[model samples]
Target: MKQSLYIYNNGDLKRKDNTLQFTTYEGDKRDIPIERISDIYILSEMSFNTAFINYISQYGIPLHFFNYYNFYTGSYYPKESLLAGQLLVKQVEHYTCYDERLVIAKEFIKAAADNIYRNLRYYNSRGKDVAECMKEVNSLRKKLDHTEFIEELMGIEGNIRKNYYKAWNTIVNQEIQFEKRVMHPPDNMINSLISFVNSLIYAKTLSEIYHTQLDPTISYLHEQGFRRYSLCLDVSEVFKPLIGDRLIFSLLNKNQITEKSFTKELNFLHLKKEASRLIVTEFEKRMKQTIMHKELGKKVSYQYLIRLEAYKLIKHLIGEKEYEGFRIWW
Candidate 1:
């Protein structure tokens, strides 16, 4: 399996024949066999030549960029060789049908809610009094079926998340507090981590969607236009709790990360490069971790699950079957 390459230090990345090489200002150099690299994430200051981009494009390798504040700015995605005209038409067809689009969107929310409940239940079984929070989420879950507009569905989703976040302290036995969910500029460590993780997950999902011939620019749950890949954002909702939020709770409660890992300036909080890399590395580790998939009756890694989710979306687009995002039954 191809592994992702993360570059977080100052360096020069260039194409070395069929391989890629990274050389530091201090003169340390290393060559990476491009075949073993699926994606490259640039987290810190770095320079790359056009030759490197051209070489990576030949192999369909994407380059994701993050700023100093850990905010995802954009990506350089290689043109996919898997694009199909029929699949693109199917994707647009689904988006154009209100009832059909809402059904898929609702399924995404339901699966997301189930995963959120699973995470809560995981901690609750360990003695957290999350029953009350679960009850609130249950109420919101029922509202998904009754939602008439996208905004209404989003409101209920937000309410469920609010209830869930409130239960974090009890579930994790950690003093790490979350005042609220902040995205524009995360005001605290928790918010900062949340923003960064969600960004990565969104981009990862987009990359997966790119491989499936689905137009990532078209989406049902989130309004599509001006945004590059809004459909990935729509699907990422289902996995954020199972992947991103769970990792955040684990790292904070285990004392793996703390206030020291954050830097505050003018009320804006950001994870330091070292801390961000620590979280990203752990996230990548989680994606590589395997779990028994009940439907497939076999073990699959989190990364594969992501790709599977994208495949499911494509299946829905092509009218092969109704799309229901993955729900946790265990």
Candidate 2:
């Protein structure tokens, strides 16, 4: 499998002959073969020469940039030829119909809620009092299937997510307390970790969207406009609870990510570049970890699980099959 390359430090990325090389400020050189890379994620202040950009474009590779605060800036997407006009029309057609769009949107929320419940159940089996929290979220989730309007469905989804977030501290098996979910300037270690992980999951979803024939700008759940890839946001909502939030709880509880990994600037808390990279590395590792897919009856990696979700959506759009998003049961 072609994997993603992450560059954090200020360095020069250039193509020498046919291979890619990164030269650090300390004059150390590391080379990577061009064929082995799928995408490049830049998490810190970095510079690349024309040769690097040109060669990446030749391979149709995308370079996504993030600022010091770990917020995504923009992407350097290469001009490519993988778009399908027929699929685009079907995507818009699905979005324009209220009944069609609502059905799809509700499924995403339900799958997300189901996964949130799965996380709670997994921990509860090991003796945590998550049943009360799960009951609240499950009640909110039931409203999704009955929602008549798009906004109402979205609201129900948000309410269920809030209840799911409330169960995190209880599942962590630690004494650290969480008042509320915070982002932008994360007030605590847990929030900071969640912010970083969610960003990675969003970017990963964007990458998956890019490869599909579906337009990322058009989405059912989120209002499509401006520079926002609304479809990516829609798809990301389904996986964040299962992939990103679970990782945060596990890492913090295990003491793998500690206070020493973060830095405070003024009132804003942020993870250092090294710390962010560590988290990203672990996230990619988790994505590669295999599990017995209940429906498939075989082991599948988490990363492929995400791609399968996208494929299911595409199938729904093109009328191949009814797309019921992945619901977590185990």
Candidate 3:
């Protein structure tokens, strides 16, 4: 698999004759072979001419941008290559039909809640005293099947996640206090990590969707709207608990990420460059790790697991099989 090329310094990006080159403002330059990159990430100040943008577009490589706060800003997505008009129509049908939309939406919530339960159970088995939180999660999750409307289903999903977040406080070290899920300048260290890592997962999901036939803008769980790819948001919910939150728990338990890694600017809490880099490195490591997939009967990288999920969605759209959001068994 090609790796994601991350640019995190002030630089000028330009084409280097079948390759990509970044020249830092300080006069340091590095070359990245175009064939070796799955995507590109612009994390710091950089300037690139139109020639470079048009060049990468030829390969359909997505460019994800992040602001200084390590918060995801947007992406320069190239035109979709896997544009199946039939699949697009089917995708819209799924969203337009209330019962059809609700089924898929509820499936996403069910899988996400199950994955969250997996994390809590893993900790509880180790004697973390998370029984109270687990009880709340189980109670809320049971409502998924009974929910009649998408709105009500989402309510249960929200409550389940809230209880899941509360369990984190008991699982991690006492030095870090994770009272609840907070964003809009994430008030604490754990919150900052949550925003930063969740953005990566979202971007990663979008990139995987680009390779599949399903339209990213047509989604069920999240209302499809302008200025955002909502399908990525729906697919990402399944993996965030699996990939993002699990990594967060591990980092905190091992003290790999500390409060020192954060900086407060006005009312916003942002991660320092070193801290952001550390988080990305750990995330990349986790994506490269493998698990034995019983259905596939082989080991697959966590990154490929995401692409497989996309393929599963496409199959569901085309009526080849049912779409069951990925729920972790191991």
Candidate 4:
């Protein structure tokens, strides 16, 4: 399993003949072998030339960039080396056909809703008073099968999220008055953390999709839009509860992250550099953690689960199998 390389220091990245090197402004250097990296995340200001881009492209490693506010900018996706023309056609066909699209879209919502309920249940079991939220989410989840249009499905998902977010106050040990979900400069620490961590999940999903034959732009749950990988958004909905949300809960409950993690002067919108690094460190560890996979009859890392979701989508597209979005069985 190659690791994701995260650059947090202001430096110059250069291609060192089959390897990569980062030189800080303070006159320090560190070398990284190309083979050890699956992808690169640039979280600080960095300068590089076309040669550096060309080198990573040859190895099929993507680069995810973030701005000064710790918000996701975009990704440097290499040209797809595993392109399947027939599969691409099927992907678009599913998106164009409303009935087919609804089937997959509903599955995505169903799995995501199930995972959300599981989170509330887990916390409720731990003595958190989220039982009422759990009831609301469970009630909304039952309506997934009846949703005939994408718009209707999205409405239910929104309501489920609304109820889920309400439970966060009781779930976390910290007394951060988290009300509703907010974006475009998240209003509080919890919202800022959600935006930052969810972006990481989206980037991670994009990297997983790049390895498969599926086109990331053609999606069922989210409308296809220019300059965006909507397929990642669709797939990320299934795993965010299990991966991103749980991680946030743990970080706050254990005091690993708190209000001090953000710059108060920036309206708590800017995550301090050290805090950002700590979040990424814990996130990487979470990705590498493995669980027993009953279907595979062995253990698989959490990161590989995203890749498996892509493979499952491919199977559904190629008529090898019927698509069923991943629901946590454990």
Candidate 5:
């Protein structure tokens, strides 16, 4: 598998004939093979010419950018190489038709809620005393199928997440004052961590979606809007509980990430470069972790699972198979 390239230092990235090269401000140079990179993550200031962009674009490598505060800025998505006009139409049709759209949207929430509940159960089994939160989440999940409108469904999802976040206080061993989920400049360490890690998951999903024929902007759960890939938001909702949240839980419980990991002077809004690198490294390892896939009768990495979700969506759009969101069976 091709690995993701992360740049956490000030540098200049240039296309060196067939390969890639990065030179730091101090004049240190390193060569990178273009074929070995799946995607690029820029966490610091970097400069590259059009020739570099053209080379990466030719190979369909996306570049995800983050601001100085470590918040996601945007991505440089390459042109679609695998375009299926019929599939695009079908994708739009599903979004335009309320009933069809609701079916896919509900599945996303159901899978997410189920995974959230599973996380609580995993912790409760380890004596984390999250049983009350588990009950609350389960009750709210049942109401998902009964929601008549999209608004009602979203309201239920919000409640389910609210209760899920409540359990974190007990699940984590650290003395974190995590009461609720907050974005738009997360107020606390937990909130800041959530925003940063979830952004990485969204970027990874976008990269996986690029390899497929699906249009990233067209989505079911989240409304399609300008300058956004809403389909990634929809697909990532199902995996965040399994991939992102679990990683957060592990990092905290094991004391791998602590309050000291963030910049206290920045109101805990800024994650230091070392902390960010550690999170990305652990996340990459988790993505490469494999589990036995029942349907395929073989093992598959967690990263491939995201691509499988996209393939499943394509099958649903083409009427080859019904869409069923991924739920943890392991």
Candidate 6:
């Protein structure tokens, strides 16, 4: 269980022999143990030398970066250790064949929609009155089979999400009036949480993909483009409802995060430094929480579930097993 290290201050990260060190601008200094770290997230301004990059690459550590507005800019991914040309060809074949691509794409959307429905059901049974929202999403989900092109599939997914977002108003505390999902400097607290948490899931998925033989750029749901890992985006869609959205509803409903926990400047809304750290802490905890997995006949941590999802995709690509998106049963 490797922990992720997050730095929110302006600092210099350097390699100190076999260890890592961070020196803040205020003249404070500290040492970070490299062995316990799996990934490093730099959320503020920072500088590092080539030597530091080489050090992390030696251990295949991922370095994720976020801009001032809390948008995920990019990642310094180490060279692939599990590169397999055989798997890469199979992955590409799935993408190039329209029937194969559409099948995988549909699984992604169906799993996402099912996960969203489970969330609404969970709250509705707990007295949230989310039945109407759930019904709308379910209706759009049935139309998924009628979609032929990727664009049409995406349209159905988008409308499903639109209705799903509406259910948040009933599930969350009254203070959060989530009209719709908005990014590019999220207009409200819920959207801000969505943007930040979704980015974390994406990065975590990318890191998981690195452990496998899959090329992260080749994807089905999202277009494969340079400077981005689109396959992670596809895999993350299935888990966001289980991980990101559930944690958000809990944080708001339980009063762990409130309207006062955010700071808005102009059109940009971001969590306060303390609030941001709190969400990160909670998210890590959620990822580490284990649940009984029927398929494995044992409990698996939420983080490992993401990795498992990747392994399943690889198996599908190689024709070892038929792929099905992970859905919540409990």
> In lDDT terms, which candidate is top?
5
Structure candidate 2, residue pairs in collision: none
Summed over model 5, clashes come to 0
Q: Per-model C-alpha lDDT, please?
A: 0.83, 0.81, 0.88, 0.93, 0.94, 0.90
For model 6, the superposed segments whose C-alpha errors exceed 4 Å read: none
Ten residues in sequence with the least summed lDDT for candidate 5 = 219-228
- Tell me the number of clashing residue pairs for each predicted model: 0, 0, 0, 0, 0, 0
Q: Write the per-residue lDDT of candidate 5 for residues 1-330, one digit (tens) a residue.
A: 599999999989999989999999999999999999999999999999999999999999999999988899999999999979999999989998999999999999999999999999999999999999999999999999987787888899999999999999999999997998989889999999999999999999999999999999998888777339999999999999989999999999999999999989988998988999999999999999999999999999999999999999999999999999999997
Where is the poorest 10-residue window by lDDT in model 3? 259-268
RMSD each, Å: 1.5, 1.9, 1.3, 0.9, 0.9, 1.3
Q: What's the C-alpha lDDT at position 172 in model 3?
A: 89
lDDT of 2 by residue, 1-330 (tens): 789999887788889899999888778899989899888998767767888899998886888888877877778777645778898898899999989998898888888888888888888888888898889987887777788998888778778767777777787766557767787567887777777788788778877766766677888888887357778778888888778987887787787777777775433366777778778888999888898988789999887787788888989999999999886655
Residues 1-330 of candidate 4 have per-residue lDDT tens digits of: 589999999999999977999999897999999999999999999999999999999999999999999999999999999989999999999888899899999999999999999999988999999999999999999998998899999999999999999999999989988889999879999999999999999999999999999889999999887338999999999999999999999999999899899999989999999999999999999999999998999999999999999999899888899888888787
At residue 132, candidate 2 shows an lDDT of: 86
RMSD (Cα, Å) of model 4: 0.9
Give the TM-scores of the predictions, in the order they appear: 0.96, 0.93, 0.97, 0.98, 0.99, 0.97
- Model 5, TM vs. native: 0.99
**For residues 126-186, could you state the per-residue lDDT of candidate 1 as single tens digits?**
8888999988888889888888877788888899899988887676555667757877777
* lDDT assessment of candidate 5: 0.94
Candidate 5 lDDT score at position 286: 95
Model 1 TM-score? 0.96
Query: Cα RMSD for candidate 6?
Result: 1.3
Report the lDDT tens digits of candidate 3 across residue range 1-330.
699888889899999898889999999999888888888888999899999999899988899999988889999889988889998899998888999899889998999999999899999999898999999998889889999998899889989988998888888875666777888768888888899999999999888889888788888988777238998999998999889999998888888888777775433377888877888889999999999998999999898889999898888878899999898988
- Segments in model 5 whose C-alpha atoms lie over 4 Å from true places: none
